[model samples]
Target: MSIQKIALVGNPNSGKSSVFNQLTGLNQHVGNYPGVTVDKKTGSFPGKEGGKIKVIDLPGIYSIYPKSEDERVVFEILKDKGHKNYPDLCVVVVDVTNLERNLLLFTQLHDLKIPTILVVNMVDLLEGEGISVDLEKLSELLGGVPVIPMNARKGEGIEALKNAIYDFNQTTWTPFLKQYATHDHGLKHLPSPSEQIEDTDRRFKKITQILKFCVKRAEPSKSRKLISNRIDKVVTHPIWGYAIFLFILLLIFQAIYELASVPMDLIDNVFLLLSQGTRDALPPGVFTDLIAEGIVPGIGGIVIFVPQIVLLFAFIAILEETGYMSRVVFIMDRLMRPFGLNGKSVVPLISGVACAIPAIMATRTIDQWKDRLITIMVTPLTSCSARLPVYTLLIALVVPDKSVWGFMNLQGLVLLGMYLLGFAAAFLAAIIFKLIIRSRQKSFLIMEMPTYKIPRWSNVGITLWEKTKVFVWEAGRVIMAISIILWVLASYGPPNRIEKAVSAIPIPENVADDAKMSYEEQVSSVKLENSWIGLLGKQLEPAIAPLGYDWQVGIALITSFAAREVFVSSMATIYSVGEDFEDEATMLQRMRQEVNPRTGQSVYNLASGLSLMVFYAFAMQCMSTLAIVKRETKSWKWPLLQLVYMTTLAYIGAFITYNLLQ
Candidate 1:
């Protein structure tokens, strides 16, 4: 009844997580290993009447020897006794469908000499494919260690596996012993070992001999070959594969805009109603204004994108699960070779849609230093969810609310265009960077193409929910804080002067029922020229004038660098002061009508709108991205270079667009 710990380890795409989910159910917590960003998942199950079992879901790794950073973490944890926790038992999850390759990792675990269980998962696929694994013989050959066959998807053989874990005893199953372990067969032979080394070596040899005896494959099934041939015909064709990939990407963008619009609208209206209700229920004061205007609007801006974020992640998960992502890497590799990037960079580039920070961090998988650096440099140009708000607002401002081809919304098309622009910029930048930074080695691509399977809806749902939750929570906090500060900055004016100026404005007798004055008239009566924010805006006017932006636009440009979405909240906070704008949309509408005192023309002309969009499209506007870049690169060099390069590009782009329009 001693507390026993079990660790689940497996190859990527081996359904190791499915096994963990089956064993642990909902009683689990996912976190990071101490001092590392790699995910650590743990859960406990009742063993006997009162005894309990602890299960740890280790990160999926291809080999214990370790090549990538994530894979190295697994090796370090298993090898180093100094690590906080050690498992009493290791459950090596093997894909029965791909046993030869999967067993490579299993042999490594056996060498560790931890009490072990081999879970041959996906047994259901064996019969249909004319492959059969002899379970009893396999168990007997592997020194009597339990070998359970399971179809994790259908909940088959789970009880037996649980029972095996509960009753597991090292003495009950004789350790397998043989010469030439599968993984170590190609390596140089080691000298005769001491007692501890000899014991571990015997265990590994036994596991290997058992694997060779028990595992059987029907002579090279033609299914994989046939599927690969058919897929390669179109997907890896010189021309068609690239075209198809681009088309699929366009389809994803279209789906994100059209499918998520209904839910986004629903969220927008709900938050708006909630804000109005709060205003009516609360006593009138600065507190009410602050809550209703600053906090609510700021947070609402981020919440509105939840539906879109979910849809994006859902689509990405589906792509990854179906194994099409590998083909994408295959196709992109050919296309990216000229740009000096490996094909695998496609994963991080695709992930940049969620956020650049994680996408940049994902470059750890790329082995080449030059490729990794170039990917990190240009990844920000991929339109992240943070940019979605800016694109949404600007597209709404400019594009007509009409549909084309009876399906595509005009606004959606514009949004799609912006995404394409970002993609094009990233590709071009990669090409330029490749040409500039010379590397000696010609890196070759080698990617495992996993078998295609229908995506699990449950997995997709959980992934979408978790990712959207993080976006809402992290972005929500920043927006709320900025909104409150902006509200205060805009609401309070210069010392005494503005208040005296407001009192001096004459009221005509004809409209002398001052309480009945329209919200517009009340705002117009205020001496906004003397207000602190107004003065600050005016001072920035000269600096922004070349870009066709007025002082108010300058204020928005300054605040937006904290986060692109904050531009909308900053404008809302600015416009709400001295005016009774009912909502964010009204604030935008009012902004369009405001005239420049110097030019006697509308402040938001076509030139300024174009300038604003161009600026946001290229700016390093997310603080989260900067922090993540710093952490991932472990140096200020890359992040600082990103900040300088992106800001310079944004300025030049905006300046050119503004000058052309003017």
Candidate 2:
């Protein structure tokens, strides 16, 4: 037999992704479908007789009938046989508890005459809910389409599901909707989306009739929803709910600060030694300088923060897998509605903590045009993982590492404060946009609360792996290139200008041996100040001077336009070029000891460090985020305005912070 292609279709929170994960394990690939931003997941697994079956995990939707562009893309791919991702067989996974609602999608697929299998999932919850399914009878009712009862989390029924996939064929079958299936193939003849509601009502009526015979329900001995409802009383409490969320945020930040310090220090020292060793092992030349100063330390600058980032992603993944994040959305809706944000806006806003790009993409679910535009414009204000390094670096530089009340890490408290500030800024910005932008659509929050369960560790592991891979690979390339370019600019200058400046620095005629080394250091500093990057930084210094930043900080502000994390790497490469790599001092130490030549004061003092942190908190420093905004809004006008407004806000915020601290 030929290799079979299968598609997994289901409603949200139906354990469809879990089924895909169980089947594909580590063989999955994530990509976008042609001409759209929606993710397309494909993987291969062994079928019966050791043949391979290709599986596509389509995005979750309630139905195939299009109500939005994303839904349209998914609908076309499923309905069109000529489409590249069209499958030979379709697997509809459904939550047995909510079978009526989920079966709507399955019935639509069935009536399309697609060779399909029905996977009745989450059967483990059946006993708790006092429900049972007559699997053989249900298959007989659907004209003998294969039905596999499954508990995907525990890997149960996977073998049976595989067998059903291989056994599927286009037999003469009775569709759930007979009349619609006969003339129109279920939905092909609908004049427009305005009429889908009538057809949907008819399908639900038939589904209600079918469920009456093939399913049984009674008062539960112990309802799982009862336990969940009890938990929700405390979790969704108006006051305590927000308190618990804040407490959780506190613990996550504290863990990040307390646990990551040792690993971060280790990484910092390892790179220092590696840079020194590279210099020692290779001939003293420009290539050696480039490797020892540019590439190694640049990548290390971002890599040192990976431990903290991993901890953040892990906590988020675990929260999501446990179904608590939905509660967060449910509670936050009340708080957000006043700010002109839909309850659905909470998902993208919360997701923005990881990265703004996907978070912006997540806004596609918001139905209101004005709300989505506002969310896109303000989401970058959230403190994403890209800003974590910048925050941790500055906080460490200015805030003393100690306990507040002998329990809380003072530094972690500061870090949490930065995130809180991001949310506040986003909300305040949303209010302003609400006043300025007009829309006729009324907002509402409609969502499902899944029964809470112990988090699936396999899901958490995969999340960490994918997030880490993207962070390293995407950020690494930009940092490496910028570092190389900065190194060349800092290492060389116009003609003999660098040589003339260095040669002009006179060694004291009767200097002590120790002071001779100091004289050589002065010459190196003179050479660096005359180099190309230094001149560029010097030109920018005047514009940024009121914010308490020096020329070096100005250079970082400029390069950070590529990505927020590049700020740290920019500093690392800049300092590495003019310093002695053989010293045991790490980049953080050098930053601490950095002094202004003119003022005779530390460069990264509290006022300047705090100013820099505030600048980063509000700045639109990411080009990729801008490109995505343009694509999502379908115009250059909004992104350009976003860049202008955010940059202006950052400057004013930083100025006030610096002056007040001083």
Q: Per-residue CA lDDT of candidate 2, range 78-180, in tens?
A: 7777788888888999999999999899988887877788999999999888898998988887778888999998889999998777765667867676665
Q: Write the per-residue lDDT of candidate 1 for residues 430-463, one digit (tens) a residue.
A: 8988887788866777777776778877667656
Shift in Å, residue 583, candidate 1: 8.6
> Model 1: residues >4 Å from true position, as ranges?
1-5, 21-31, 41-55, 153-160, 172-212, 219-228, 504-509, 512-533, 578-607
lDDT against true structure, model 1:
0.75
- How far out, in Å, is residue 271 in model 2? 1.2
Pairs clashing within candidate 2: none
**TM match of model 1 to true structure:** 0.87
Model 1 worst lDDT run, 10 consecutive residues:
182-191
Clashes of 1: 4
Kindly report which residue stretches of model 2 are placed more than 4 angstroms away from their true locations once superposed. 47-52, 183-191, 223-225, 508-513
